[model samples]
Structures are given as structure tokens and as C-alpha cells.
Target: MFKLAGQLASDCIVLGDFQLCTLLLMNDAQYPWFILVPRREDATEIFQLSVADRSLLMEESCLLAEKLKDAFAADKMNIAALGNVVSQLHVHHVVRYRKDHAWPAPVWGKSPAVSYTPELLNERIGKLRAVLTNGFTFAESCP
Candidate 1:
């Protein structure tokens, strides 16, 4: 499972590079989405991290979720770590709304991916990255 392309072999799916996880953007645009990929060499599970790293990862997840909540003014935050689809040991932290496309249900397999405009994507990423940097600093390998 080891890919030597560095931490971001794919689009970041979570908050920002400030944490051990990278943020991935789901192709859907109806909701604010993100994924967190822990920067470990072919890590397969959260428990695989050292005790200290595990604790930090959890803390970072929670904190980043909070930031997403505030920044997006979202109604709820969906945080999950399911490796069934992509087995790179990545986590998901998504902002949800009552009126979103997959409202009142899970977002998975609900619809096709919605593309984002480059300008919009860049703006949103910049804002989220700012929040991430407020209290977190990225290791060289992370960014």
C-alpha cells in the first residue's frame, strides 16, 4: 500500500496540511466536504499510529471539525474513518446542512460528483487552510 509520491498522492480530503492528515475534496458541491489522510508510510488503520500520534490525530480531527463548523457555518459535522473504499488509512470530516443534497441521510452513493470551479475551490481551500493554521503547524512532510 506504500506509494512513494509523498503525503498527497491524491487530493486532500480533510482540513489542511497543518495536521498529519491531508484534506480531500469530494466531487460533490452541494455540501462542504473534506477527507483526512494521515501521513504515515502505507498506514492501514488509525490504531497503527503510535500512541502519541494516535492521540494527536484524534485531537486534530476534533479540532479541525470544529473549525469547519465555524468557517462554513455548517449545521453539523460528519467525521468518519472508513477504509472500505480507499485503503490508504484516510479519515473524512465533512460539513453538513439540513437542506443539502443528501440531507436526512448519508452522502455516500447518493449522487454523482459535482465539480468545483477552480476559483471557488481555491478560495474555499484558502479559508480552510487559514483556520487549520491558527492552532496547527504542518511538518515538512505534510505540506
Candidate 2:
């Protein structure tokens, strides 16, 4: 019964599913950001997850952070799971650089999210998919 929220579906590009979570790329082109949502219905907090699922989420988050850092050569990887907005059990992995648009500050609210052109969106997703497929066992689920 797990389903992505309407706001999430509107703002993210579906990447693929991990063993316990669905991976999504935030639609904002300003940063190399990804979100991981556990495939559990109506669970809004980390504590709501079972102990094993909590451990699995950490493992998945770490692996994704490493891969994103490698793929984008990011100076830092910001991983968080603040649910103030969507109230879903999701983790965010954002690849950051010292010279990025919102350097020295958080990316949220620094600038408006830039929408991607069709070609650019496809290219970005393809690059990410390549890295994920090479590093993990996820099959592409996004068109």
C-alpha cells in the first residue's frame, strides 16, 4: 500500500527502488539532490521504522552519499530527513560544492528551483542511473 505523496511525485523524478526504499531525484536542477523514501505506508518518522529497517535506511543512505559524491565530485554530501514539509519518511542526499549557488548556506530557499529541459533531465537521469547501476543492483524504473 505504499504510494508516493502527490507533492513528492510532482517535484521528484523517480529513479528506481532499492531493497527497502524508492529513490528519487529532486527536480530542482540547482543541486545534485536525491531523496530516498522507504516503501512503507504512512510512516512519517524514523522511529516508526523497525530496528532492522532503520539500519537498512542508514546503509542505503551512506551508499547513496558515496556514489553521489563520486559521480558529481561534490565537496560535501548533506544527508537529512526533515519531514516538516511532506511529512513522509524520506531521506535527502544533496551533493554540495563550496562554489555552488548557495555556497556556505543551505540550498533550500536560497534560490528558486530551476526546471530542467527535456534533454537536460534525460541526461542527468542517465548519468545517475549509470552510476547507480554500476555501484548497486537497482534497475531503472523511470522513463
Candidate 3:
């Protein structure tokens, strides 16, 4: 059975699920950051996934990037799968703006993460849910 990394569970709110990944919203309100974690046990790298799963992951990542770009009117979409901290095979999709706090630099280590209030969190999730349709299923509960 697959289990979410403890760090991830503590840092993010369950957003929803795709065909092969569980979507998570990084609790930080600074940026519209999201993560897609494959529901595979003990898979620490993209190469660890089956060929079909790899392909599906790419598709899902691209779809998510596009939707987030449009939803947030982002200047850029930063997508990466660096598992240095958390070994789980998860992809990050961050919506960036030119005027954001850390524009030229990566979001990591640049500044502290600002968590959302309950109302703001719900509003952000609602915007995401509105765009992430079709193959996406919203989570029943976020907390």
C-alpha cells in the first residue's frame, strides 16, 4: 500500500486525485504551489515508475501546468521533481509572477512560507477546482 510522506502530509492540504497521482496544495499562501504524488509504493524516482505510469505522469504534469498558468495568469510555471528533502516521487507545479517576492530566484529558501487562513484556503481551492476538471476529482475534505 502507498503512504504519503509525513512531511508532505503535515505541510500540505489534500486537494484531490488524478488517475495515478494524489494532488496536494502546499499550505503556503505566498504562491499557488501544488504537488502531484504518484500512488506507488516505495517509488522514489521517475525512473522507478512503470513506462505507462511515466507517460501518464508527464501528461498529468503538463495538464496541471497549463491549468495553473491560466487560472493564476502566471508569468511562468515552475515544474520540478527534486526529491532531495522528501524521497517520495512527487512533482511540483508553482505559479510564478514577475512581481512575486522571489522572481528571479527559486521559491525554495528564498523566503518563509505564509500559510493561508481557512477562508483564503477555501477560495484558492475553489479556483483550482474550477479549472482542474475532467480527469480530476476534488477531495471531499481538505483538513
> TM-scores for all candidates?
0.79, 0.91, 0.97
**Ranking by lDDT, best first?**
3, 2, 1
lDDT by residue (43-95, candidate 2, tens digit) is: 99999999999998988888888888998889999888998889989999999
lDDT of 3 by residue, 1-143 (tens): 99999999999999889999999999899999999999999999999999999999999999999999998899999999999999999999999999999997899988888999988887888788789779998887854
lDDT (tens digit, per residue) of candidate 1 on 3-77: 423343443333335446555666556667877667788687888899987987887788888889999998989
Q: Which candidate tops TM-score?
A: 3
Segments in model 1 whose C-alpha atoms lie over 4 Å from true places: 1-16, 135-143
Stretches off by above 4 angstroms in model 3 are none
lDDT of each: 0.70, 0.86, 0.92
Error of 1 at 90 (Å): 0.9
Q: Top lDDT: which candidate number?
A: 3
Between candidates 2 and 3, name the one with more favorable lDDT: 3
- Pick out the ten consecutive residues of candidate 2 with the lowest summed lDDT: 134-143
Tell me how candidate 1 scores on lDDT: 0.70
**Residue 141 of candidate 2: its Cα lDDT?**
59
User: Residue 82 deviation, candidate 2, in Å?
Assistant: 0.5
